[model samples]
Target chain A: MNAEAAQPYRLVVVSGGTSDPSSTRMLADRIADRVASLAEARDEKVAVSVIDLRELANEIATALVSQLMGPKMTRAIELLGAADAIVASAPVYKAAPSGLFSSFFHVLDNDLLIAKPVVLAATAGTARHALVVDEQMRSLFAYLRTMTVPTSVFAATEDWNSRELGERIDRAAVELLLLVESGFAEKVRTESWKSYQHEYGSAGGTELDIDLSTDLMRLATGGSAAPRRKP
Target chain B: MQFGVFSVSDITRDPVSGTTPSEAERIDAIVKIAVKAEEVGLDVFAIGEHHNPPFFSSSPTTLLAHIAALTERLIVTTATTLITTNDPVRLAEEYAMLQHLSKGRMDLMLGRGNTAPVYPWFGQDIRQGLPLALENYNLLHRLWREDVVDWEGEFRTPLQGFTSTPRPLDDTPPFVWHGSIRTPEIAEQAAFYGNGFFANHIFWPSSHSKRLIDFYRRRFEHYGHGTQAQAVVGLGGQAYIAKRSQDAVKEFRPYFDEAPVYGNGPSMEEFTKGTPLTVGSPQEVIDKTLTFQETFGDYQRQLFLLDHAGMPLGMVLDQLELLGGEVVPVLRKELAARRDPGAAEAPTHASLVAAKYGDAPARQPRPNANRGDNVTGGSPYQDGDAQAEYPSLG
Candidate 1:
């Protein structure tokens, strides 16, 4: 076991459902519960935290327009920054994930979730939109460089009652549990963080490392950007 | 501490009046505004540069030189002169002339402009903005200090034995303040040169500005310029003050709602709470401005964004009265009392000249007769060392 394996794994759930008792949040919670019980069966502890996008709807819109982070939005970023793994669920509108879900991720720093494990799940009214999870949502997390599990959970009205839905959730839960147990995210951050591109104050304001030895930094300190002339 | 007012030179429509001022009218009004700033005893008046319509002051030095001629004891400056697109050679020449015209009563802050299209208009790529700003400033720094420069850089053509005319007022370069919202490299550049770092403390939360300012202070000390406490810092503030807090809020709400940069976004109350914008009575403005010292340490200058959002000249003049007459006097006393003993004073022409030449006379550079070629040759100035070597043309 690694140093991180001694502590309870922190699993964060982000739900982009808009209504009370939303199916999107329910799907996320079901996956989170399955992951928790699966970890417990292996004699490991799991701590789960939920980020309801409905609560942050206004804040997300405000951030989209003004680049200002509200208190709730700031807290949500803090939780995600500390999370070991994430379960992201959204209600499909038209043929894609809800704007609230996409906007929330859009406001996050590009490097915030580097190498972090995630379980992408989505709910739609029809089976026709089932591919939204893998096609659209996965690409967004991919751009963020998250380590999304191979098994993505998708639920339509019909699938919610089908037994295979639960089986897929179980498969995703175990995949995430194994990834979290391996400490891939922690290792990448600890060992290879400098290899990734980062902006100053990015990664939820935690990426503050500045490399002062670059060519631009040399120019900043009065050295010329041009090649030195031969004597 | 120095107290001043800065404008973005935005010709916004008055949401309350439902009218927009003509560019000519706004231009005339800004001159009146700067005159009133000094009339009411404010120390500085700054104007911003923009190339687009609905923004008038594309030529900051032209406008500032006029303002300096109109008012006495009021230092005129740019809120930010673009360092990315404008050639460093032109900036060195024009600002030196302005320094001479104003008799060392002018200084400027540098910023990479936000408008992307403006870059291509001047044969630049916005993607290269940061490097361009850093490199151009590197050249501009040499032009004012060194009489003859032989330079090569990435963005601009190389300079050979080039001398920028007018050489700065009494051989003193106008003090510079680097304005940045988030870029640490900008702060590093500012600290590397011992220049002031000005945070546009109006748009973002104070924490953002605090992080940048703290980094600047550390690097300033690292560069051995001074102790962290003695690094010069400037903050931008926004306020709408009245006899009562409620009246202030009521009067400013329409303008705040329809203003261009942040309109249709956060509510006035929310923005006021989140950023350094204060809409309250004179005492409240004074109280909130004082907290800036606590947050960023004792700093040198505080500039307020007073005349934007289509605010009429009459209303802006009233704000200047409440600011210069009521708010600034109290703030001056309070900030002076709270300042750290080791903190540096705001840079001025007299002080910089005194620092450069303690008892000796300042160097007055007189150019040798032109050789008709572009080259000024080595020892271009009469006072320059004659023994300096140059390749023989033989």
Candidate 2:
């Protein structure tokens, strides 16, 4: 079933961090809940799937590089690929983002994110590393050609206790909802230097769109999705 | 050159005055510190993976995928992705998807985790942990490079025929840096594959890390990756910098004394004297870190455990500023001066993957060979002729 069957807007929550009842995961939940609530308020049907990467870490990792997808991860990957918008949250590790989270992204294809919209948020102590959302996370979004909502919410530990957090999260969620309703707020058009066709008359460009749905069938039969890149 | 910050995921009491931040507060604090690392300009950001209590992240990949949608230029990597317990097949696919999501800004370091009990919980025996890592990684390597594989291995069931999904963006697998502290076996594994070797050299002095890295470099050459100098190496370190050395030590002492990992052993002076830990001025850190090369020879990546020791997020950010503004430029210059003209510069995600499994450069595959049977006689089975059934072993 597609999102249209379940709901028009789906919120996919990515909770990244170790399993110590992290505030980062809480932050992810808060944003997700807020988004769900907002969707309900607007009388819009929305589906929410919380993928605690910790639970599926083993299978997901094994499935990714080897192209072995368990039923659960396959469902999760499909949701992630088809989601209209996403709210991603992680606790900062070191001065950047968590390595576990990076590992998860490493297995994804750049084409999966083309023209998708995303909302980025992070949790940290004090106000020291708040800018990581823009400096680090947003940069990755830009590279993947995803449309990131402008207003990101970065909450410090102190901000959590403050009443302002709910309002802030709600505001970010509302902004994302607005974008989801409106479609791409900013149109990003990459400057293509050249375009051509292969000897077999296959149209190719710096970025080309092929029917992966058919490729998926071939992969199912061959039991492999490995690219034909020579080592 | 490498720059990164790692988190300990702890909320500790201020040793001077018992003030323990709630777990919630500690987690939020870590998030901010990571964002700040990027703002100040750092190359890579890595987070540790732990399954037990006190360590918040059991799912580093999910977190990383989220972070991938967040960052731009910074290369995201794991300080340690547990290779012992985690299934290599999943590791392969998840990271490939991440590479796609991040637009090629992803890579990781493989390590056998510190904890022991984590093994059995995952239905694995800690006794066979090293074997699992070795065998699993070998499979993972093949999964990334090969399009279709008929693989059978000890740990996982046989794959009559298999291909991972969500093909890699650049058709390149993420670069891997095998991280180890004292294990020469891990070094050998890394060297055998021509992968980078990282010494999370926090506990030991440069001399100790040097022995392991040298072993890896030598073995790497033996395996035909390149010369010893051409082998990629990364080091892990710890530091707390203040303008004044006295103040730096004074402020960090309590946390050091109470840290779950470091609090138990040697006296502060003794620990500082022998280990890579440095609690002093920015200049002192630079001086000590630069000496790493003298001891270990030319290295590639350098990451520090700054967010650990239960230090507050505010103080950690201050350290990052100094690191970005004061430390990085000087270290870059000094390392550049000392670089071996013959040795390749440190490999970034782009460089490493290209060197390993990049798109076919000269020997390109013929375009429509698989489409028609005219050339090599296509498989007897057409696209949908049958399910391509494999007989049951039982």
Candidate 3:
């Protein structure tokens, strides 16, 4: 929604940290602050919500094993669904982001995050895992078909004492804000929705791209339902 | 409305006993269960088709034919006869043969079975599942309706004047129900043909069913099949009942926790609340089932999964008894009480014959003595008075 018209932009932060005093959640909070300040600087209002996947670890495991999303997962999904921009941060595991983070997205409907601008960040113990955001998380978000901001912020133990971490965070947050302010996600949702598969049961716009003249649809509407795409 | 039981035919080990029923034992149990479906007051019995181990019913027609021969009243069907891998021509012939054998007491639900390896086993590509299903069903629709089908589609070889043998009984094909859980296009296809839409309602949430069923109903009305209320709908549910609800849960927990499809995913309570699986007394089952009608509107058929997760043969039979005697009779009356009078009855061969002929004599589809040229013959039969006109799209 256009902030000048009706509603402020929705920003969702997903933190995949497993422990207290988590550096992953700390990066997510900083990214959220940077994005909010950037949007405020541009005279645009934004509403931010944080989803701590650490709290939902058991639920995620159950959903993975069961193929059913319980109530907790559903709330997390809802927050993502309404997001104009996403700040996703996960602590590095092995050489990649946490499996808890990956599984949470797997449990989501495929079409949920298409073309949304996602700012990628990760907290690692050492600089050796610094490319976790670029090498792993970038392609992960790419699979969901989200537009990852060019500048991905990575926080390592040494980077916390350096100025580069704050600089990268500012760059990533500003890039996300630019995309959000330009309504890029909404544009993709509206303009290219037909290019994606329309899941029937999901709540969204249904009137835009349903081709009524297709044989099945023609049979469905009995030749009387109004023709879509008159031109 | 018709109410019945459908099984996946999984030969699972009893989680409590660690004893897996032998294939022979499971097979015998399934046949007995089907027979018991009719022995009680149930109206339908559907068996699933699986080519792999752990699931035994490979030839549904053979099994259904056996059940049909054994029972006089019950409607025998497939939970889903795979539409993607199986040839449509064979489908037409085999189902017609089943119809003849059953004496017009069979119908089948079609699905794009998600078992990936089965696709390659049958020489089909899993990636083309949707298109294969669509094109194959388009041809199958023709094979049953048209006397001579000249067909070409993306997945299969072109047919040159293929005449699928043993025409459907009464010159009216068995009614079909399309079973879908998530795909909207499948619901669209079911509505397109004015066929029944069966939601696999046990695994998924009611919101999912509500959306798909409501979509089908609206499209059914749009397609001039009927008002949204008059559209034919079938739902799959699961219930385990005892005299007391707690006993039902205690008895069913092990089976529920270890079953292949949904085991180890959600707690029984979470699953019960999220989806349609109910473990309770007869009264509780009845109460939960009534909510289905309230949610999806008055539907035409309700099929429950009674025998899965290696519940003992004795327990399965006992569950069927409760379902048929205690649960279904009440559901039949309660579902009927609020149903719109003008809504279509569950379609059967006899009902379809009545629909095709009204009071007139239904066509017998007599065969010619020896017709060599099925391609050029104006009518392929000798007593070719009433060759029904079919859509020539395929």
Candidate 3 residue-wise lDDT, B193-231, digit = tens: 888999989878787778778888988898897788888
What tens digits encode model 2's per-residue C-alpha lDDT throughout B209-324?
67678778987898898999989898888888888999988988887877776575455675677678888988999999898988887888888888766676788889999888
The DockQ-based CAPRI class assigned to model 3 is: acceptable
Write candidate 3's Cα lDDT for A62-119 as tens digits.
Answer: 8888767788888888788888989999999889899999888877766788899999
Candidate 2's TM-score reads 0.58
Clashing pairs in 3: A66-B265
Q: What is the C-alpha RMSD of each candidate to the true structure, in Å?
A: 1.8, 25.9, 4.4
Question: Which scores higher on DockQ, 1 or 2?
Answer: 1
> Best DockQ goes to which candidate?
1
Which 10 successive residues of model 1 chain B have the least lDDT summed? B385-394
Candidate 2, residues A14-98, lDDT tens digits: the string is 7775776978788888887887788778777667777777776764554443433344555666777667778778778777777
Q: What lDDT would candidate 3 get against the real structure?
A: 0.85
Greater-DockQ candidate between 2 and 3: 3
- TM-score for predicted model 1 compared with the true structure: 0.97
DockQ of each: 0.69, 0.01, 0.35
lDDT per model, in order? 0.92, 0.71, 0.85
Docking class of predicted structure 1: medium
Model 1: how far is A145 from its true place, Å?
Answer: 0.4
i-RMSD of all predictions: 1.2, 20.4, 5.0
Return the lDDT, model 1, position A185.
Answer: 96
